[model samples]
Target: MRLAIFLLIFCIFEYALTVDQTNFKTCDQSSFCRRCRKVKPDNPKFALVPGTLNIYSDSITADLIHKDNKHLFSLKLEALEQSNTFRLLVDEKTPLKPRYKVQDALKSAPKPGSIKVHEGDTEFTITSGPNKAVVTADPFRVDFYQNDILTVSVNAKGLMTFEHLRPKPQQPADGENAENPAANDVKEADEIDDPGAWEENFKSHHDSKPYGPEAIALDFSFPEAEVLFGIPEHADSFALKSTSGTDPYRLYNVDVFEYIIDSKMALYGSVPVIYGHGGGTIVPKKERIRRAATLMKNDPYTLVVCLNSAGKAEGTIYLDDEKSYNYRKGEYNYINMKFENNVLDVNFIGKPNFKTAAWIERVVIAGLGRIPKSATLIIDGASQELEILPHGEGVAVRKPGISVQQIYNIRLNF
Candidate 1:
């Protein structure tokens, strides 16, 4: 009986590997995506109306209209003062009902900066320092430029779509009149045909779509980027690949079980952030060393600083001392670090009324090239030039007074 049960379980596991994935919707299956992809660059339906621009102290607002439907949309462009990042938002000017907007995700409201809007015959440009956003009137497109280099663009390939809310058509009962004359007349007046506008279904699940189709999609193009990363929380590679033949990178959060790898299928968590880098200019081979700084705070705090010799400089610092009883009682200590020109300086500051035996047990500084024959370590007011021991492609520097409760300055020079 035991042998039979074991073989049955193994067979079931093997069969589960080839389970059907028809429950997931493809781009063509989605009504909004299908309609958006059909819009050509040369013949777009949406256009920015002239003389509707409103320039404020920190943002630029305008109204865009659909040529065919005559629907109006509000467009706002703001430049973040703190980070110099630009944000472009588009929504219905006056939606019939309030549409769902994502909230509680941002750490806090962004600080806005002054932006000057330059109006021209063909386009309106918003300039803030070295970053500029050019809003083209016809065909409705926005391009972001950093230091005169085009970094990102929206609707560059003309895949923008905004499904407006409308009244759901009432279905006639069996044996009753198929359609009313007035309703048919209105349907013929509007050329757009939305088959699954009122409701959508996949497998055994049905989406009632109470507020109608309100899906918004826009294509973002990065012209001067070679590699893109982030948007993780997936069991995939760090470097994101192209989604040419497969589905686009999905951000919808789902509880996936035994999710597939190397696909755009969203897993446990979803964050709508992506980082792009590695473009333009090459540095000298000898001066290509990369450096990184990280801070880890917990019951026990730790800081990691390293330089990349062979690969990119990266490390994870775990803090296990932040949960101590003294910390909860309002006692705090800090470690300040500064790195300049092949030298690392660290200063430990302790609280006046709090005295706890806390110390950094291990400090690993990797990518030191070769173990130096001798190095200098200055602790407190004393200096000692000691022979350094070789670590894995680096050197290990240890201090005896790191655990004591006193202010000290430790400087390491290679």
Candidate 2:
């Protein structure tokens, strides 16, 4: 009993010291984040320059100016081929030095799509397929719409804070401003100054930053979203919570010691991709595969098959253009495959059900340089046949019947 009490007390003590929050910096400690958080909503400080838009087939570039300091920035918005994905980029028009751009970030370059521009006096809209982005001129903001529904807005809260590269200020000599104290005070009031912008000290480490602040910050709002997710590699809830009364979530990666489970502290890596979902429908099983085939008919689908002696099944299929970079537009054709005993229930409406219920046992997609009209289906080494049906730039193959708990192989010849 004495030994059991000692072990129980030790476990409680260790749980209490799981994480030390003081080792990390909060929003108040980060100068750039602190200044950005102070920006009030509805008070934007940037505007689009008139007559500076250069519209291309797949992208649109424009000049944006800061309303306060009149800083010139170049903006580019590109549309991906999947029709619903867009990439927006902003940078200094002419910088003192080249800024760092992430490289090798994607598996392949995204396939660009042709965009149609609709210009207006105060706002302009760029559209690809059913997706549209309306860009406002004054107090520059981009409202992204999927299927005509407003889903995401950039710089809507006007919390954008970009600190351009600047030379360090020379310290004034003692008594230099004593003669003109009133004038110096007026000049200081008008200057945008933050003591931590040049250097920061955490614990005993004093970082001597030679270059002035180059931190960039922007706010995104999801007006009609039911929940926000992404910004992965965080040990927090899958659905993000409001940072209203707490420090805003930080994205810098660090090797934290015994990181807190429910906190937003960065772990090993960071991928700054945040997306919001509004509303969706739950399709029934009878119509699920049919709907998936219809939705992904235009794109090439990936077929993954996993087999094991154990009675379980799992796989995935991501639909995309085989030779184009269009998959970056987000989750339009992402499908998760999971089943028990490798039983794939394929329901073909208006067709008779038979005892030989043919299902996808294994699929191998190779040398698909072109779309084929039919595919060869093989089941249990006893049956080998070709199911042929010409789809709209796609192929639909159906096998009449095959018993369950048997291995199946499908080969596509393109």
Candidate 3:
């Protein structure tokens, strides 16, 4: 009994040590996360076929069903605005439910741009501006080209899998009216409580996954880039390392107990972002808009940030009329932005999930409904160079110490 009490005291001691919320999760706290860290290389599934395509005003999305239907997998391709960055998303279409998108890092919803897609002998030509873009797609491989130079390739190694969400049926093949009433009830109960899919209770924490198995995994290779960076919220160094024999970068956002230093684990905020570094890489900071001394940084050279909304990004991107976000227009200012004019505001990026995010916002507000609005929101705008004074509850979530979030402090300059 002494040992159990000692362990409990240790956990509490560790939890009290962290502030500023930088370190989110240690590698050990997460279950599937720890499992993914120890993956092997022998087989990666690369299934691609000419599935279907949908065209909208600004963005165009295409579905890629795996050649091996054994795994119900689908990949989405999107042409976004500004630099016409092509975004590819891979996930299980009919997962138990849906996946959550954490693409709030993008300052605005990128506009849909045009791509000159032409059929080639083996591959295809997809160019937007002056660059000669190429896409070589087959059943098990995908290669991207820029100016005849192969840049990024997906599924090159082939170990991409989307753990499909399935209902726990006592027997999948059980008839609608099974002979045994007891057996049917048990099957129904199991589906309601599929431990493998949703409702994961870990370490005195109950994570109610309204949407079931929506895990996304794929291998992207940057043949030219030797160094990579940009997946903040971890205590690790700026530069990333090989998770080959280790863990794939964790993306789930959770309130970790006592996150470790220099390890791959989910944190308070997640930006599913990465960039090539070293040769021609900038200091990662951009010029400040109002000259508060903190300039936004420069974006990474190459990246693959995934955005899977509540159920899907389906029909969501099209809902926006003029909802294309470039660099400097939104709720969250882009730290490292590529903009012509200097404009900083708090906003969101990617396509339309405003409604979906609204639902999330409502849930958040409802759960913390007891907290007054005056106390809940920190009213601070960087453009005006002003801050809000927290009533009596004290600084909520942030401290206004030489940072932009000081806007929450209502201290007007007289």
Per-residue lDDT of model 3, residues 1-414, tens digit only? 999999999999877785533333444554445444433454544444554544444433444554434545565555666545576667765665666656676657777677766665555656655433454555455666533445577777665555556653434474755666665554321233223345566556677654454445667787645578777577787678777555566666767656768766656767667765322111222223544432222211111111111111000111121334522333232222111111111222342222211111100011111232332222433322323233232212222222321212222122
Each candidate structure's count of clashing pairs: 7, 3, 28
Q: List the residue pairs that clash in candidate 2.
A: 111-325, 356-401, 356-402
Instruction: Report the alpha-carbon TM-score of model 2 versus the true structure.
Output: 0.65
lDDT of residue 368 for candidate 1:
53
Tens-digit lDDT track for model 1 on 1-414?
999999999999877874245766887677766555565664666788888988898898889887777889999899888536688898999988878788988758888887888889999888888789999988899999865667788888776778787766666567455555454445432344666656777778788887677767777787765668778476678678887656666676766576766666767778888765433211111112235222222112232345432222222221224456665554654434544344555544444444555454334455455554555656667776644556665565543335433444334553
- Name the top lDDT candidate: 2
Q: How accurate is candidate 1 locally (lDDT)?
A: 0.63
lDDT of 3 at 228: 87
Q: Candidate 2 — what's its lDDT? A: 0.64
lDDT at position 275, candidate 2:
58
lDDT of 2 by residue, 1-414 (tens): 999999999999998868777777888877777766676887787899999999999999999988877778999999998535899999999988889899999878999988999999899999998889999999899999865667689998887767667666666788887888664452332255676878888888787666677778788887655678777477889788898978876777777657778887877777888856433211112122554554533322223222222323334333334444544444224334433332332222222222222233223321122455555555555545566454343244554344322345455444
Give candidate 2's error at residue 289 in angstroms. 25
Cα error of candidate 3 at position 391, Å: 54
